[model samples]
Target chain A: MKATNLSTPKFCSALQILGLALMVFWFAAPVLQAAETLKLSARLVWGTNRDKSADDELKAMTPKLKSKFVNIFKWKEYYEISKKTFQFPKHEGKQIRMSKNCEIIMKLLDKDTLQVQVIGEDQLQRTVKHPLKPILTDGDLFVVGGDDKDSYGDAWFLVITHPNLGKEHKKEE
Target chain B: MNEKLVIQIQAYLDGELSAEARLQLLARLEKDSEARELCDSLKAEQSLLKDVGEKDHELPVAHSYFWKAISDEILPHPSPRNQTRHKQTAGAFQRWSAWLVPGGVIACIALVVFQKGLLDDVLDGIKSTGKKAARRAPSFHEIDSQQQNAGFISFRSESEGVSVVWISNY
Candidate 1:
């Protein structure tokens, strides 16, 4: 082999070509790898909802939370612990971390029957006699038909026999 | 015509009568003009009844191709133009928005300037009234609870609640 000197024009061209090749390789490698295997993730706060999608409903959730996390956080994400089952990360408290997701899809189902009633604004009772009484007071929801005053101009509420939703909720207009 | 024959003629037209009644009505139709007219009217009515129940109608097509056809015909022409116009309109709106913040601040400042004199007069009146009240007001100190119970109580002569017990004239 003929030994070429370092100052040769051919040596400079070869070095320039090698540098360009390395630049192109590293630039295109990441793009190709990203297209091949993508790792999708979203950021979530410590204890709140994500976007407006209702797919994230937390129900039967009885996680003992610390005061700093439960009150101050604006969002929360979740991850799967097992197959189709998941829990919030136990980082500082029992709340989820921001690494998994900002939203947790916890679908809730009512096991028992729900009874709804309306409370009348007027003091007098109605003429039509119902067999069962209402469970709630005036302007309250009845799970099994409470003592709701059935008359016009009275606000009504929803009552569920389910333990997850035992409290009275304002009915949407 | 006899009443029994009239009843037979009615029953024959209604298909309730025997062959004798039908034969009798046919013979009467040959002779009686009114009987023939009634048969012609009854046949017309039966034909009309068959047509009454039927309507030349059709069910609505699934998914309503009306909107789809309209979309296919009208959408491509306007969609890109609509997007362009939307962006243009948004640009115009953003340009207008640049003026809005300054305009709102100017309006708020103008409103405050307009109401400033009235608010200042009210505040000035309140201050003068406070000064007048301070000057006209009494400087009496409230006696301690235990001290008041131990001694005879006194009220100013202008007091509304009780008569004065420590008047100099007394």
Candidate 2:
């Protein structure tokens, strides 16, 4: 049998391999970037002048976080009714139930943005999009709150935060 | 020669005319010499083109060289000094073009990474500024409440590092 000229120069073959690798990386860059998920924590807090919560399961708010609310609003005490820690994928929405009557839908709009919809009594109360970068980097908080309809002068707050940053803050505390 | 008769005769030659139209065209072709001549010329031209297409024809030079020669002939010839300058310019252009695709790809990747980093930095700066500002300042980019029974107000206390959206009457 005649010998076939299948041999390619080593340099050319190496360059070809490098090119193939670069092409694969170029195509995969976006997908790899998109794989990153945003971790968040949402808390349903009840604000009242009363010293204690009627539900024993409810926990008092962190002193650092509650002081923030006390400075801004009229509520004397803030109690955490429910808390959820979840991950948000890019452009996808997640519905989180904070209580029987309170629900929140959060969507990761992009790398630096989050869309939040507050649902009270199965009705959409508000929709907000928050710039995520500041919240993620600066440990900023996003809260959706309203007056407690059942109780006069009582209020409810839905607070959102970056879980990692929140944990770091707690560690520092 | 009538243009209509010429078309009919051509269509009959191509076997495209209806049977009744072909018979009428054939009768006219026997009676009209000018129509017959036009039909004969169109057939001759079609046959000549087919023959030229079917015959194998080879270029005297390589395909690239052939095109280059034709382009050289069509484009103006430069002076010796100008030709050297042109070659240098072309060489530089070719070198740049070689790097253009890879450079562009790298630039795009860098831009995406940089923009993401920059966004974090800028937003951090904004938050810092908001923190340094007065109490009850807003931090959210947008807030839209759709419920008629409830109205909402949002603010951020940078000192507390907390943002609040207070919905009233809900």
Q: Per the 3 Å backbone cut-off, how many clashing residue pairs does candidate 1 have?
A: 11
Worst 10 residues of 1 chain B by lDDT: B161-170
lDDT of 1 by residue, A59-134 (tens): 3122321121233222242222111212222121111122221211211111111111112222111111111111
Q: Report the C-alpha lDDT of model 1 over B1-170, residue by residue, as the tens digit.
A: 56766666567656898788677678878998876776677778877887889678898876748666655675445578777987787677667656655565565555444433345445545765554332222223122221222342333222111111121110
Off by over 4 Å in 2: A1-15, A53-55, B1-141
Model 2: per-residue lDDT, tens digit, A27-118?
Answer: 87678667767788999999999867365677888887877788888889899999899986665688999899888899977666689988
- Chain B only, TM-score of each candidate: 0.27, 0.31
How accurate locally is residue A25 in candidate 1, as Cα lDDT from 0 to 100? 58
